[model samples]
Target: MGILVQEDKGLFHLQSAGMSYILQLVNDYPAHVYWGKKLRSGSNLEGLLNLGGNRGLDRLPQEYPQYGTGDFRTPAYQVRLEDGTRITELKYSGYRVVEGKPSLPGLPSVYVESAQEAQTLELTLKDDYAKLSVILRYTVFEHTNVITRSVEFTNAGETQLRLQRALSASVDFSSGDMDMIYLAGAWSREGNLTRRRLVQGGTTIGSRRGMSSHQLNPFAALVKPETDENHGEAYGFSLVYSGGFEAEAEVDSFGMTRFTMGLNSFDFAWLLEPGEQFQTPEVVMVYSSEGIGEMSRTYHRLYRTRLCRGLYRDKERPILVNNWEATYFNFDADKLESIAAEGAKLGIELFVLDDGWFGKRDADNSSLGDWVEDLRKLPGGLSDVAQRVNNLGLQFGLWFEPEMISPDSELYRKHPDWCLHVPGRRRSEARWQLVLDYTREDVRQYIYESLSRIFSTVPISYVKWDMNRCLTEIGSAELPSERQGETAHRYVLGLYELLERITSEFPHILFESCCSGGGRFDPGMLHYMPQTWTSDDTDAVERLKIQYGTSLVYPVSSIGAHVSAVPNHQVGRITPLSFRGDVAMSGNFGYELDLTKFTDEEKELVKEQVANYKQIRSLVQQGNLYRLQSPFEGNETAWMFVSDDQREALVYYFRVMAVPHPPRRSLKLNGLNPELDYILEASGEVYGGDRLMQAGLALPDIQQDFVSGCYKLKVQE
Candidate 1:
C-alpha cells in the first residue's frame, strides 16, 4: 500500500514513487512533519515537537492552522459561526485508507487508472466547539511521485455557518531561508518564471479576474537556497483550478514557513447551511530532492497522464494553422477557403477560422454573445466555411468567445441582466466586452446550448474556446446582498459546469482553451481542454522565453505554439522563417501565418517545416523533457526530449544573439540509457549515451541571431 499508518508514532506516512509525506497528530491537530525525500527511519522528528513545547503553544507543524491556537501564524482554514464568532480548533477524529482515489465533486481532479496504481487517505477532524468537521483527502500515486490534496468542510451544527477562508492544501516547514518561485505576466506574455527569497509576512500571488488571468498563475514553488534545476530540494504546488485562486507563502516570526493554495481569500466567502458542505478545489503537490528538473518532470508526467483527458491526451496534436493573425477580421468565406487550400498544400492537418465569422462582428467591439453566423463574412454561415475547409482535406475548427457579451448585441438587448453588473453602477469593459454572468443558470444553459448546437451542425473537429476579458462590477444581481461575495467563486463553478456539459456532450470536438491567449491556461482548464494557446504573441524571440517558462510545470503537449508571420503580430520583430518553425516545433506545432501571401521560397520552407514536424511530433508530444539551458539566464536556450523507452531523443537549441567572437557552448543530454550507442540523424554522428551525457556534444557555432537547430538521436542497436 502506498499509504501506511504508524500506530505507535501516530503518523500517517504516504510513500509515493520516490517521495514521502508524513503527517503526525500533534496533541490532537494533524501536523505535517516532513514532505521531501523518502524517509528510511523516523529519526528526523527526534526533537521537532518538544522544541515547540517551550513556546507555550505547540508550534509543531499544523496541517490546518487556526486562530486562538497560541500560534500567531496565518491559519490554513477559517470559519465564522452564526453569532459572528470566527475561531475553530479541530482535533483529529479518524481516517480511512482506501485502495483508489475518489473524484472531487464538480471539479477537475486526477484519476486513478486502477486500484493497484494508487491509494487514498481520508482524514477527518472535528471542531466539537463549533460542531464542524473537516475532511482532508490525500491521494498518492504508485508510479508518479505526486500527492494530491483537497479539503471538504461540513457544518453539523443547527446554525448556518460562513466559511471566511478555505484553503485546499497547506504545507508547513520548521526551517528557514526558503525561496518562492512563481509565474507572472500579462496578456501577450504569460508564464514568466520568477524566483524570490521567502520573506516574512504574507507573499501572495493569485487571480481575482474570474478566469485565471494572465497576471499570476496558480502554481508556486518553495525551494531551499541551494535548489536549482538539477540540485537540492524543492516543493512544487499547483492548484487544479482555472478560475480565481491564490497561492500564498508566509514566513512566521518563529522562522517557520507555510504555503497554502486555494480560492482567493479576497471577496471569497461560501455560505454553508446546516447539513451542507463545501469542497475546496484540489491541489497537486510534488517534492523533488533531485532538484527543480525532477519537480518539473513529475508534474509533466502526472498532468499529462492523470490530469489531461480525452483523445488528445496521448495522441499527436494536428499541425494546425489558425486564421486569427493571417487576415484578422478581413477574411470572408473566400479568403478562408483560400487559406485552407494553402494550408492543405503545406501538409497542415487543421484549419481554424478565428473570430470574424460570428454575427455582426467585423471587429472585437460587437457580436460577442451572438452565436449566429455573420452573413456579411460568410454568406452560407459557419457550417458552410467548415464544410469548405473540410473539403480541402483539412480538419475544420471554429473560434468562440462564449463567455463575453457585447452590450450592443441581441442577447444583451433581449436580456439586459444576462451580463455581470452592479445595480446603478457603471459596467466596466475590456476590449469593449462585458463578461456573461455565468453564475446565472440560464446564462450557462444558453451559452452551452448555443455552442453545442453549432458543434452538432457544423463539421467542426476543433473549437478555440476564448475569453477575452477580465471580470468587473464584481456583483451578481442573481444573488442576495449577503451572498454577493460568493459571486466570483460561483462564477468559476458555473464555468466548470458549462465546460463539463459542452465537452461531455460534444466528445468528438477537440477543445483548445484560450483567454485572449494563455490567460486562462491552467490545470483546471486543461482538464476539459487538453491544450491552450500559449500566448497571443507569436514572435519567436518572445515565445522562446514564454514556452520555456510554461514548460516548467505544463507539458509541451498542452502548449499551443504556432509559427506566425514576421515581423511577428505582437512584437513585430521579423526573424527567419526557420527560427519560427523551430520554436513552434517545441510545442503543439502549428502555423498562424497567411500562407497565400508567402513567396515561393517561403512556401517551400513552410512545406519543409510541416513535413519535418511530422517526423518528431510523436517524440516531442509524449517523450520525457529536459531543460538543457535556460533562456532567462543567457543568450542561448536549449531543451531535449527523450523517449519513454530511452531509445530516441530530439534536442532543440536556439541562439538569440550573435557575438563578434563567442565561446563554444556544449549541450549535455539527460535521461538517456548510458550503456547504449546513439546516432544523430542530422550529422550522422555516432556516440555512446554516457559519452554524450558526460562529455556533452559541441553545437555548431552559427554566426546569426535567432538561428536554431534540431538534433535527432536514436539508439543504435
Candidate 2:
C-alpha cells in the first residue's frame, strides 16, 4: 500500500488499499500505463506500457500531455514564453519519493496527521530551452483507494513567463465506453444528479461565477455504461478549489478519453518572474471497483476527517435555531429573545440572529459592510443581546456577509472603488449588493479587523459567514492593468487568507459557509468551515433530492439541514412537521422557523423530534452511509447509517407522494454485520442480520403524501 519504483524500467507504481496507478517514462516522456484494480507485486508493468505498440504522441496515454508537441489533445498546461510562443516540451529530469504528503503552499488540501499514513511521489519535468521546471505530485494513502494529484511550475530562467492555462491534473483512459456523471443545478435546486454517456466530442462542467456556482460543482465521475451504485468500476475526480473551475471529459476519434480538472482558464493568467513559482490546487481521484457508492464513501471519509478542521470537525453539531426565515430583516431584540426562549424550552442548543442586526439595515438593500449593531433594534448593542440569549441557556450566533457591500452603506459611501468594478462600465448588482474587491490588502484587512472586533466582545459561539451574490464586473482596484485577468483567482486566494486568519484566531467558533444557501458548498470552504447550509429550499420534498445528491461527494456531517415552516419559504410546499424533521435529522439538525409561533401540540412534537435526534446524532454524523434508493430514480428515497463497529444502525425512508393501492415493499439494508442478530428499537422485534439484509424489513403503510419513517437497529448482545 505504498509507492513502488521499477527504476530500471522507468516505471512508478502508486498503490493504495484497493487500487493502483502506474506511469512509465517512455523516452523521457511520462506515459500512463494502468489505473485500476491493484496488481500483484513484481507484475510485468513494463510490458503493459507497450501493449498498444509504438504509437504517435497524439495516441499515447500521457501522464501530462503537451500542446504543439506531436500531441493534439488539450495540454495539461500552456505557457507564453518570452518570445510569444505557446509551445514547450517537458522531459523527465529527475524524481524522488517521500514518506509524507507535503502541503500545497497557501492552499487547502487533505492533510495527514502522521507521516506514516501516506506516501508521496514528486516527479520533475524540465523544459530546458524555456528554462521551465514542472513538478507533478501524487500522494497515496495507506488505508484508502484514493490518490491526490497537483502541479507546481517554477521559472528557473532569468526571463519572466506568463502562464495562460495551468490545470492541476489530467488522466487518459484507453477506451471511451463510459458514462459521465456530475452534479448540476441552480440556487435552490443545487446538486441534482446528471448523467450522460461519453461522446466523440468534449463534455464540460464548470463555474465561471468568480465563485463555485450552484449551476455546477467542481466534481465529476466516469463509470462503465453498466455501472450502478453497488456494482462496476467508477473513477471520480474532485477539485479542492472554491473559485472558477472546469472539469472536462474529452473523447477522441480512436475511442480514447481524457479527463482534466482545475482552475478555469477563462480570463485567467499568472505572471511568473524569474525564481518565482506557481502552485495549482489539488485534485483528488478515487478508483472504486465496487461502484459509485464506494467512491462516495471514500470521498466522504477523507473530506470529513482530513479536509475539514477545527474543534467541531469530529463533534456532533448542536441543534441550532436560525432566525432568518422567521424574522428576516424585521427582528428586534425582543423578537429574538422570544425565539431563543422558546427554542431553549424545546432542546435547541443554539440561537442564531441572522441578518438585519447591523447598521440601519432594515432590509437587504443597505448596510452590508457596516458591522456595527443597529441600536434602534437592540438599544444596548450586540453584547447585550448575546448575553440575553446566553442567559436563556443557549449559545448565541451571528450572521455576516463580510464579502459584500451595499451601495447605501457607509463603507461603500466612503470608498466607492472598494467594490469590484471597471472604470468605464457601470457596476452590475445582484441582490442589491456588490462583491468587495478582496484582492486588495486594505479591504481584507478592514474586514478582518471588523470581524475580529465583534468576535472579541460579543461572546459569540457560532458565525454564519454568508455571501449572497457572485462576482461581477470582476476588476480589482489595486491590481495593475496587466494583472487584471488575475482578479478572480486572487480574490479566491484573499478569501482563503481571511478565512484562515479569522478561523485560526477564533478556533472555538463554529463557522458555517453559505452563499444564499449551497452555492459555495465545495470542499474548499469545508476546510475552514466544517459545515455548509445545504440549500435555501427547506421543503422536505425538495430536500429529498438535495440531501441525497449532496451525499455523493460530501459527508452527512458537512451538511446543515433545517426544518423550516410550511408552506416553505422557498418552495411554498406544505409538508408535515414530522416529515421535515425526519429529513433534517439526516444532517446537522436545526430549525429555521419561528419556534415561538408553534402550538402546544406542535411544541410537544418538536420536543420529541429533538430528543430523538439527540439519541441518534452520533451515529448519523460519523457512521457509514448506505443509500438504498435514489430520489432521481423514483418517488421513494431510502438511506441508512451504520456504526463503525456494526452494532447499531439508523434507517430512513420517505415517500414523496404516496401511490394509490401501492404494493407492499421491503427495503434491503447494507453495511450491517450478517453474522449478528439485531433488535428493532421501536417494535422490539428480533431478526437476524442476514434476514434484515437478504429478506429485508417490511416498510409500514404510509398513505399520505410527504410522509417518512425511521427505524433504529441494535445488535442483540
Runs of candidate 1 with Cα error greater than 4 angstroms are 41-54
Q: After superposition, how far is residue 95 of candidate 2 from its true place, in Å?
A: 0.6
Per-prediction TM-score to the true structure, in the order listed? 0.98, 0.99
List model 2 lDDT by residue over 651-679, tens digit each. Answer: 99999997999999999998899999999
Clashing pairs in 2: none
Q: How many residue pairs clash in each candidate?
A: 0, 0
Off by over 4 Å in 2: none
Superposed Cα deviation of residue 73, candidate 2 (Å): 1.3
Using TM-score as the measure, the top candidate is 2
Q: In candidate 1, what are the lDDT values of residues 1-717, reduced to their tens digit?
A: 398787667888899778888888877778887787776655655334545345544366788888776767767788889999887888999999989899999889988788898999999999998999999999998877789999999999988889999989988888768999998999898889999988887888988888778889889999999998889998999999977898888888778888889988888888888999999999999888888998999899888988888877888899999888889899889998999999999999999988888778888888888899888778898878888888899999988998899987999889988889999999998898899898999999899778878888889889999988889998888999888988988888899999888888888888999998889989999999999998998899999889999988999989999998877778779799998999999999998878899999999999999999999998998888999899889888999999989999999999988877788878888889999999998778898999989989888878888889988999987
- Angstrom error at residue 631, model 2: 0.6
